[model samples]
Target: MAATRACLVALVVALTFLFMEGRVTAEPTSAGSLVQRRREMGSLLRRLNKPPIASIQSPDGDVIDCVHISKQPAFDHPLLKNHTIQMRPSYNPRGMHHDSNITTHAITQIWHQNGTCPENTIPIRRTKEEDLLRASSIRRFGKKMPRSIPHLNPTNDTDTPNILRGHQHAVASAQYDKCYGTKSTFNLWKPWIARGNDFSLTQFWITGGSYNGNNLNTIEAGWQVYPNLYSDSNTRLFIYWTRDAYQSTGCYNLLCSGFIQTSNQITIGGSISPMSTYGGTQYDIDILVWKDQAGGNWWLQVGGDYVGYWPSSIFSYLADSASTIMWGGEVFSPDAGQTSTHMGSGHFPNEGFGKASHIKNIQVVDSSNCLNPTSDVGFITEQNNCYNVQSDTYGDWGTYIYYGGPGNNHNCP
Candidate 1:
């Protein structure tokens, strides 16, 4: 009888803790705990939402703040306190020309329909109080869990370890003696997500160091539809970096202070418009990341604009050059079982173009700072039945990969 009473008390304490953290509704939280949580959230919002010289309300309900480049969040880091922002890359990779024979489609953000941010200012998506409320906690906001990146060259093509961690991927990777940069065009889609906590994304990873240790350095840029992170299901452009394998020291977009923004035209977390429909007109975005050998900063170029860069001083291994480059789609399910969340365009890679999502013209920058087509490419995925990847080469497209699928289907479940 005494043991039963102790268990009941412990359960009650656990319930109270969850309630106070807004993780569960099993019990009502105390007034003091709720007020304290509110205070903490307010303080975080104030720090993130810097004063803006001008603000534009996006059609999709996002407020784009034109913050002065000098006052942006990148300067908040102690390492960057005395850093100077490089307006442009010292040297672009040689042979970085596009094929005139390949037809191009235009892509723009929903916020652009209103107005663009002024020159000498960068557009930042304002974070709201509700955004904080969606997170499991204030500390975990805008951060990916540790080991979020896929394994580098898994021994087996199955990659069962990643599946056990609730992360799925269909990616093409390249490993070289030294990799200075990579570029590709990713097909865009608003794939369905099973839960608010689940996310679907298409991106590329620039990685160095060992994944086994905490020294993994990675710089990532992509479009993701993450409802829990943004408080909505809209697809948004995002960038992330970590010197320590996501254990700490990085965040999505400008939530943290490592990446310096230089582009006035593009908003890091703004919603992307005109998603591709099944068997219809397709829209894609060109993402390019290259290291400036002179300044040692890794620069990010979206289409034609130089978005910003991850300063070389922030990384140990990546301060020199990347060892591997990966491009593909990933889906996250918080549950132990399979989730219904879709990856890529929510269709199998066998469906081909116009139906399946793909990344084309995959290339890598060599030691000589010249962009060349990737050779000896490989693909990996956790579950082949649920999601798969295929690589091929063709005219104008050069090297490309088709990937993604609907999750929790008959074979997947």
Candidate 2:
């Protein structure tokens, strides 16, 4: 029995050696050792099921998140030779509104690179010194500044008289008397009716008339300041009426007729039409200034619409400087025998009457300045058009030649 026990012990030792060497072995003789081995095998299997850890970086070079591959093999493990380290980066892959630390230079760089701005990015530029200086000058001198000429504001204070009535009456009587149903004769050489150096005048009236069955004698009537004297040709400024009842047809008709004159002459004319074909409404009584372009050329614009243009060959002479100005009340047609009956013979019942229209403010603008002011360029002459009627009013319309009222002051007796 002792020999049998010895043989059994030897067999168990051999089996233990074979098991430790990873070879197939018989049952273990010690149950405690077998239990310990089984526990260790379980621990190894559990570790194999755990994930592997991976590190990821953000775009800004910051460490974002760390992930553990619990089920995948380790990167350097020999058993994972057929598998690759997939390494899906752990990151907050979502959009963000990044408004912090934004700089102009950085934005410029981005624009240069992308050729366009990104969404929600507004591009801003620094103002130049010259632009600042020009703006400041305009503010100081109002419309007197050359750069603020296009944006000249309309004046209030209807009392001031800048239109020369006598001159306008003479021209109208000579040009459209027959069409206006009047027989008055206009004397162009009258000393009192001649234009001054400034080309300013008062003493005019707005007239409305009809010719040859058609109402062609309609115009915004007022004294016009031309760039020269002795001719009803070129003008600089025109002051007329502002009453809404007489404005609609008269304003547009004057735009069509007066736009034919080719020179730097400002023509003030109107009509009494109660309706207009342009829109279906009557316009407020208003004045218009026809700006003569370089060649006997001219442009007719009212409020903001560019109504018409005249070629340069129509005028006898063109006014080059703003200083050479004349004042008159009427406009003459060189070709009286034209197809339109109102073209000639100043004795029309509608042409020669000098009735006063409800006059309003005067406007002075510098054409030399190309910049448009903040004010509405078209509606400058309408009522309540000034910024400040008290102080800014005088700057826009000019002070009254005599008494200070509204429409009454527009005439120089």
Among the numbered candidates, top lDDT falls to 1
Best by TM-score: 1
| Candidate 2 lDDT for residue 347 | 23
lDDT by residue (69-183, candidate 1, tens digit) is 9999999998999998899999999876475686678889999999989998999999986687667667778999887788884653343577788899889888888899899
> Which residue pairs come into collision in candidate 1?
none
Give per-residue CA lDDT, model 2, range 248-292, as digits (tens): 211221121112221111112211122111212212222233333
Q: Where in model 2 is the C-alpha error above 4 Å? A: 1-270, 273-284, 290-296, 319-361, 365-413
The global C-alpha lDDT for each of the candidates, from Candidate 1 onward, is 0.86, 0.23
TM-scores, all candidates, are 0.91, 0.21
The superposed Cα distance between candidate 1 and the true structure at residue 188, in angstroms, equals: 1.0
For candidate 1, report its TM-score. Answer: 0.91
